[model samples]
Target chain A: MDDFKFPYFFNYPPYFTLQPVRDTREKQIQLWKELILKYCKHHKVFLINLEEEFPLFSNTSIDRRLTYESREVFLGALVSEGRAEWMDKGHKKCLILWRRIQDWADLILEFVHEYGLEEGVTTLEEIRTGDETQGTELAGIDRVVLVKALKLLEQRGKAAIFKGTSADDEGVKFSI
Target chain B: MRRRPGISGLQTAAATRDQYRSLGENVAKIRTDLMMEQLSIFRSQLEEFARKHKNDIRKSPAFRAQFHSMCAKIGVDPLASNKGFWAELLGIGDFYYELGVQIVNVCLSTRPHNGGLIDLEELRGLLSKQRRSSRDPITDDDCLRAISKLKALGSGFEVFSVGNRKLVRSVPTELNKDHNQILEIAQARGYVTSEEVQVSLMWHSGRVIDTLETLMKEGLAMVDDGHPDGIRRFWFPCVGSTSGAVEAGSELSS
Candidate 1:
């Protein structure tokens, strides 16, 4: 296995503990905050196991890992800002509210709207890996994210994306 | 912990009964003197702001009303927690004005942040430019005198009154040296992050008067020609103190 290394800020003591200084904490929050979103997005991580030792949660070379309380606080900050969501009442499984359900759904509608695919239907797998969605926000988009976004447009009576031939062949049919 | 000075040479409160009795007189004297000078400065600053931003001034009735309400409630116009709110409510202009004035209300005193003579000059400059001016009806001297009557109002006013957990005098002069050690013991971060200190002292009218009086007589911390920022701030301006720095965070919740 390759040796692991932490970033420069990973060695900063405040990275592990909660910062109380308003200004310092703010900057710290910005750095951690952006990192959280970026890391999750890159890994296509839909869920963050809060109780388990996630690699992103720690930097062993620097001997620094976020405390459970700090983890909760950072994640809580995300949840508050609508960037992430709690999957359960216990908050053990955070269905990373990344990209926002509305926004993800907007992506689908925009694809349909832009491509003029209003009456056409496309499979969910097709959306997850279609040439049309390539390099767009929709490419490699989480299945849950796709469903939620489509559901949002559905509520608006704009389109419908749902189950197709059996359980695996789900698709969308845009009413518009 | 004890606010009263406890130097060895200084007579103990009990031992110096007569001196202690005079202590009340001394506090009253200091308090009175500080108020007069502070008020003169306050009125002049207001006049200057009114003069300089005449058009924006006229347009910002809602923002002004919000400021007035905050000032009335706690002698400080409370700043909105978010900059977006300020932009939406007060317009994108005058962020410095919002921050400056609110800092006065919070850290400084009820006294306006400028001197009367300076304000008169600012007002004069505006008038020279041929602009309509506020008939505020009170000269700096008149306002100063009127506020001198409020010399007692600033009494018992304390920074600890501002709610940080409503922890009375919970603010320490310095961050705990152990903060670094605690961080080391706790998490993964190890880089040093410096804090940003913002400072603006607003003197109460009563305090202004007292400053003026004191400057006339004993000559207290009078470095910046009647501007309390110079004296109270010990020269560095606008959040320079190593102690007063607060941590920075994201500009947006998003």
Candidate 2:
């Protein structure tokens, strides 16, 4: 992973702790949410497991770390905003949708149009790892997120997903 | 001989008028001189009294407040200028000016954490720490006066009350009426519930929530979800001392 540059406030110790003041905490939470999205987008980080140490959630320079409860609260806020999702019933892992699903679906369509892939058949794996997607944001995209974005397009009848002979492989046929 | 008598009578009358005019002028001059002497005496006595109580004025908050009131009555403002006799004799002007600078420094340094708002007592504690070498005791009133001088800097420095506690705001953020009312309601226990605001302020739940949400967005309030009753409690850090809030938190947990 490349070095993730933090915003100036990332070094502030209090930013790591949950503020008890409603107004201050709200501002703190807003800043936290923005920083998290920016960091995730920059590093292509899709999942934040609360049980594990996330570099953005802890500032070693100030020796301050967000408590588990604060982590949940911040992630919960993101979930409510539709910018993230709980990966399981335990709510320990978060799927950060820095780009909303709708936007992701649009991006996929744009990519298809840009590459003249309309009415073309491609495996889900190829869409994410294919040489054609090498320099695009679709490269290295999380499989779960890609599937969800594809399903959204499928719901609209713009694309179709079919299970391949192996469970690990899936193919998407874009009709648009 | 008759003509000479008439001229003498006229001369006597003129002399009498001149004498009365001189007498009146003499009385007025005497009164003016006496008043000047009395005023000089009073000013000198004030200077002597100030000299005797210089330490008291600096060390005791009560004495300093009294001194300020006396100065007000006499129209003598020691803080009016940082030069001349008052500044030289008392150094009060420079004292507050120095304090104002230190306040700005503390506010700037803590802005990233508190968002330009700090509890007045906390500020005093920090200021006293900064001025520990001087051994000059400071008080809330002193801080108030010092902060007042800082208003001239146009830095939006002002002292405001949240509940009973005072907070110093270094930034120009406006706290609307709804925010102040919520803060005032939270003063008793350092925290307030939305239900409490609704009941006490007679505000609808939506209004209460809207106001509280705004306060939270501004970083002036904290939400506590640990209550067993499950009612979210909003805590105001600016409404009370940190230690006091900690104690209150412990009490709630217990």
Candidate 3:
């Protein structure tokens, strides 16, 4: 696994604990939110499970682990900003939309136009793991998020999806 | 014979009055002159004493504070000007002025992070860092005096106490009675829960939460939910010694 380069303050133990000072805590939360988004975007991390240990939530170099409450609060802040969503009612897992669905849809449309995939029939798996997506941000994309983006495009009449012979295989036909 | 005697007696009485008046005026003149001479002597002696202990007075905060009180008793204002016998000889005024400038620097530099409100001890620690090489030590009293001088800038610098700690506020936010009362209650234990605030302040829960929320909004207070009692404790950093609390927090986490 590639090591994510944490910011200088990441090593500071106090950063893991939620500050009690109102102004200090707000700044701390804002920094945490930014770092989380940047890290998720870089690593293409789609979900963060609070019940399970998340690497970003702890810094082994400093031996600081964020308390569960702090984790929930920080994630709660992201959810409120619409940048993230709770996957379950318990908020045990969070879907990190580092790039919002709307933005992702636009990226997909750009990819389609760039690659001349506009009138081409391609499997959903190919779009995610095909040579065309190789080295692109769409490579290794989460199927759930990819489906949601494709559905958005399908709603706009820019694309269509049909099930392939295998239940796990699906194909998309882009009209644009 | 009676008239002649009465006339002589009146003349004698007038002479006696004149003699006594002259005598009284002479005594008053000598006493005034003597007092003036003694004051000059006392002034020079004080100057000599200040000159001899200049380093002690400057290096030791307790000594400096004592010197200030002594000067106060004698109706002397050593900090009256940056240039004078006291300023030139002892330079105490310049010391405080330099401290005031450094305080402004620290407060301004940390203002973004602290929202223009800093704990007094924290400010002192930073100030000491700036003057680490200097022989003079900065104390809470020194910081208070320096901040008091910063008030001349009209930049809204002021020192106020909350609980047992002092906080320097560079903003003009007025803390009302409710805010002050809440801070006062938090001083006893470094924190106050909503129930504690309600019971001690004789206020409704709504009022207690409302004021605490306002304080939290202003970044003057912080909430802690680590307690097992399920009661959220609102901590006032400005009211409690931050170093002590930081140590306690680290200990708990460790």
What is the lDDT, from 0 to 100, of the residue B131 in candidate 3? 86
What is the lDDT of every predicted structure here?
0.48, 0.81, 0.81
Cα error, residue A136 of model 2, in Å, equals 44
lDDT of 2 by residue, B1-254 (tens): 45666788999999999999999999999999999999999989988998999888877879999999999898887887788677888887888898888989988876655667788988898788778897678888888998988887787998888666788998787998888898888778767999899998899999998898777777666666544465667866565454343344344334
How does model 2 fare in lDDT? 0.81
User: Candidate 1 lDDT, tens digit per residue, B1-254?
Assistant: 66756674366655688777799899988998898888768756655654565545334645455444544574533233335433334442343343233222333221111111112222222222322353322222222222222233443222211111111111122213232122222122111111111111233345444433332222111121122222221111111111111111111111
Off by over 4 Å in 3: A1-26, A31-51, A55-176, B1-43, B106-122, B162-165, B225-228, B245-254
lDDT of 2 by residue, A1-176 (tens): 55555654554334555776665667788888998898899989999999999988876654557779989999999999999999999999999999889988998999999888899988988988999889898899888899999999999999999999898898999998
lDDT of 1 at B194: 18
**After aligning candidate 2 to the native by TM-score, how far in Å is the CA of B29 from where it should be?**
7.9
Query: Which ten residues in a row are the worst by lDDT in model 3 chain B?
Result: B244-253
Question: How well does candidate 1 score on lDDT at residue B115?
Answer: 13
| Top-down TM-score ranking | 3, 2, 1
What 10-residue stretch in candidate 1 chain B is worst by lDDT? B161-170
Model 3 root mean square deviation, Cα atoms: 9.2
Cα deviation at B58, candidate 3, in Å, is: 1.4
